[model samples]
Target: MVRTLLALKGALVRGALAQLLAAEDDIDVVGEADTPDELRSALRAERPDVAVVDGDLVTADQLGDLASDRPAGCPDGGPPGRLLVLVQQRRAARLGPVLAQHSRRIGFLSHDVAPGRIVEGVRQLADGRVVLDPDLVVAALAVADSPLTPREREVLDVAAEGHPVRDIAERLVLSAGTVRNHLSRIMAKTGARTRLEAVRIARESGWI
Candidate 1:
């Protein structure tokens, strides 16, 4: 039996992902698509065993289509192709629920996941098992209590690195006062009394 994968990626990531999936003996990288509409149509036509989607499409509609789409040929009644998202560890919290609702068969991995791990994930997904980064799962479980926004998380992450407000401002290209504002909001959201306390809260809560 010939197995296939439809790789969905942005222009910057398209070539490399295709090259990686095409090299596998059990896997044939069937096609590629950049947009959700194109991807839906392509998957319906080819019915690949898996689709490796990019990490960046976070909207509900995008995730919904990625999870289940009723293209004319591949109606809504059957089991959909397994969905594996290549995402950064930090974005797991944001992407978790959407992935979960789509199917427990879903998994997330860092963009830096080894090529072998990527191949393994695709195969596991095809076999009806979940494949996820251990660290990403841990991070997701840890961040369950955090309601932190992404910008605040970015600020807290920088602060965790021991960068003072001024340095963080320079590195992030935000003004010192703007950085302080973000810190203040971070503290308020986390209920921390000071910067160190905020960093400690974030670290302990795994919001970073």
Candidate 2:
């Protein structure tokens, strides 16, 4: 059967993948989108068998949105199609939690993978199969045993935005000293020499 596809537009690499997939006799490139709004619009208008999305379209906080939009199951659980995100290894940890939960219909590959791999991934997604890069999976599992708590993660997330401890305290309704204590513990847990390093670790691990 001929499969329809929509690629969320971003890096030039995605364009190459689109052209490669379009060359396949069994696949048709139906649309391309540059933003989330455009992607949604194309989804409604094209009704393709699969959507090739950029990792930039997904945020750490949108885990619920991805899950709600496409629950964790096979072809019958949620929408009619699936999603294939182009995530780099650097972003794998941040993208892990969501990936772990929604591995059924949602798939991902490294951004720098070969065109043939991308074509194969698209075909798999069109066939209602899940495709996750092995390296991405390994990176995801490496951070699975995170040592930070939700409150600590929130603190680090605020710190990551270049906020001062006092400002983070005010935002979280905690005292400045309490925030410092949290940061101290966070540093210990993450083995980070400084608050900034802790924040970086948390951000990379999707802890925040």
Candidate 3:
């Protein structure tokens, strides 16, 4: 049997999906989680063959951590199992980095896909295959190529939250001067006359 875990935000959705997948003779619903922490705990406890996660419930960084060979909470430091993320097309760009890092082991599907598709996706992922929705593929590709370096992106991400240079520095543990320098580079790369404009451009372009 293919052991599966469901990690969506809604209790009703989780229960419904569990019932759907459990109806398959070859599939078993091993566990369910409604939050990132619960997902981690369930992953460590069940060590399932596949995990179906809602993209809205976890950030890209959290997904990256879970996608690592030895994910957080895994006592034996073993693989955390394959992931099939249910994400909206608009939010797909945020997954670029993690998808690039764990291409083969992770798959993406539209959040609103038919229930049968999700069930089939779990089987495919368990068999070591990658499944990607065409619309999400296009959405991921449509994200503008980011000119800013990773550090600049980090600075801009904090800046996007309306944080000042000093706050950004403190949050990122960088010197204030360094943060200012990063901001300057970000503005130049984005060709924006002001920091707010830069943040707007970066956000609209899905660079941050």
Best by TM-score: 3
Over 1-208, each residue of candidate 3 has an lDDT whose tens digit, in order, gives: 9999999988999999999999999999999998888988888788889999998777666788787746556567666699899997766766677777887788999999999999999999999988889888766655458786656766776687788888877766789999989888888989999999998998788775
lDDT of 1 by residue, 1-208 (tens): 2355545556657777667778777888787777666667777777777778776533333565567654355444566677777877765555545555765656677878887888888888888887778877766666567788656776777787788999877756679999999998998998999888998877766676
- Candidate 2 per-residue lDDT over residues 167-200, each given as its tens digit: 8887667899999999999999999998888877
TM-scores vs. true structure, each candidate: 0.64, 0.66, 0.72
- Best by the lDDT measure: 3
| Model 3 poorest 10 in a row by lDDT | 69-78
Better of 2 and 3 by lDDT: 3
Superior candidate under TM-score, 2 versus 3: 3
State the lDDT at 85 in candidate 1. 79
List lDDT for all candidates, in order: 0.71, 0.71, 0.83
- Residue pairs with backbone overlap in model 3: none
For candidate 3, the per-residue lDDT at 106 reads 84
Q: What is the lDDT of residue 169 in candidate 1?
A: 79
